[model samples]
Target: MSTIDRRTLLIATGALACVGSAHGHGEPKHPNTGAPVAKEQQPWGIAGEARRATRTVDLRMLDSMRFVPDRLAVKLGQTLRLRIRNTGAVLHELVIGTPAALDEHAALMLRFPDMQHDEPWMAHVPPGKTGEIVWTFNRAGEFAFACLIAGHYQAGMAGRISVRAA
Candidate 1:
């Protein structure tokens, strides 16, 4: 008999899961209400309410593994409604986090390509579809957003966010 390690098991099962699972592409949700969580804090900021969004920033994800307007600037404490459109034929996602955090997550993604974890700071947009992430820049610092989808981030599907202190 042959023994399959965890990594091998996961990869084998992932293929089946990917085929059978329903992929949801959006912010973290409440288990009871299925509503987007609006108040988780991070080094960059916190989840924000859509109604409280003071401004809207439109972003486009391309098959070239890049984000349109790959850089952004915002004032500390301002709430932004990031409207992301996937103009690519493949799925792309916008995940906001510190560089280190993103790097760690991206590494994990490479190992478990079919991981379905969702957070308030990420949006997984499918081909020709749109998604949104409302966030508040409560902390003033540099951050980043990337698509941690298997080979996506490694291919440089990333962007920067600069939050200037008010």
Candidate 2:
């Protein structure tokens, strides 16, 4: 055979050897490429599994304002997963507190020049992004959640979370 043919044959043989070794290791097979799939790329194949394990909640922010759901009733002593999405132009936060606690917290937050709300339990979510929070409420009471970012709470970004005994 010519030198070019020999070089091509050697390259093909090397590729086939790599494929055979990968197969022996029980590697994932690429659909169209017919090659061993990388670990990171395997997520594409198990995307549904990953999505099934996560719980998501959509939230929106607009003009430095946050519009959240009015009421959220959860079971006491149960872990709750929350996903807050900011679909607004400005930054926002999700603050959790009791109604009385929020009242005091909101007052305290206003004292700081940069602080918008007073609640200690807060999640800051930037524009066009989502933030996740996992919380367990042991007490059954009327708890409030709001965005204490300056005027966000006043702009109606607050909601009530009623935890009832399960």
Candidate 3:
């Protein structure tokens, strides 16, 4: 298997292990009422309130390319739910950052022993699979979204996001 496939398998296995062993410490008891709490009240319960709010964006990845929207517009201070689907034969990443930051990260990403696992802003999605990124863009500026998979960016697999002032 390729390096990307190996890393992806490891990540998926780890996530599965986490989900399987996420039970809270014993049964939870309500603080004020001093009563045994429902399963939903457990700290690690899946039905509990979310830690953060979210938004959703659907994107697609083609072979050696990112089919991200040409210009994504959003307001500052909004949490983003970026869902990227990979329809490509090879691995891809969807990273969001300022132009300068992208340039810096791209430089660092190239130096990783395995280019597939180098970028901190990148998430691995196998071909025909989907992945998500929950992010908050706090600054108002023009940010670029790209797939920094080796020569993917140079192949024009990049787009821009405009953050309007609140």
lDDT of candidate 3 at residue 72, scale 0 to 100 = 78
- Report, for every candidate in turn, its global Cα lDDT versus the true structure: 0.80, 0.52, 0.56
Q: Ten-residue segment with the worst summed lDDT in candidate 3? A: 40-49
Using lDDT, give the best candidate's number: 1
For model 1, what is the error of residue 91's alpha carbon versus the real structure, in angstroms, after optimal superposition?
0.6
lDDT (10s digit) by residue, model 3, range 40-82 = 1111011211235355778888884757565677777666767
- Residue 148's lDDT within candidate 1 is 90
TM-score versus the correct structure, for each prediction: 0.80, 0.59, 0.62
Q: Which lDDT value does model 1 have at 160?
A: 97
Ranking by TM-score: 1, 3, 2
Those runs of model 2 whose alpha carbons end farther than 4 Å from true positions after fitting are 1-57, 62-64, 115-120
Candidate 1 per-residue lDDT, tens place, 83-151, comes to 999999888899998787777677877887766655578888888888889999999988999999889
Global Cα lDDT for candidate 3 = 0.56
Q: Write the per-residue lDDT of candidate 2 for residues 1-166, one digit (tens) a residue.
A: 3454345334533554455332211122122343331321110011112223334445554554545566777765555556777787666767675555455545545654343211113456667767655555566767778776555676777887787887
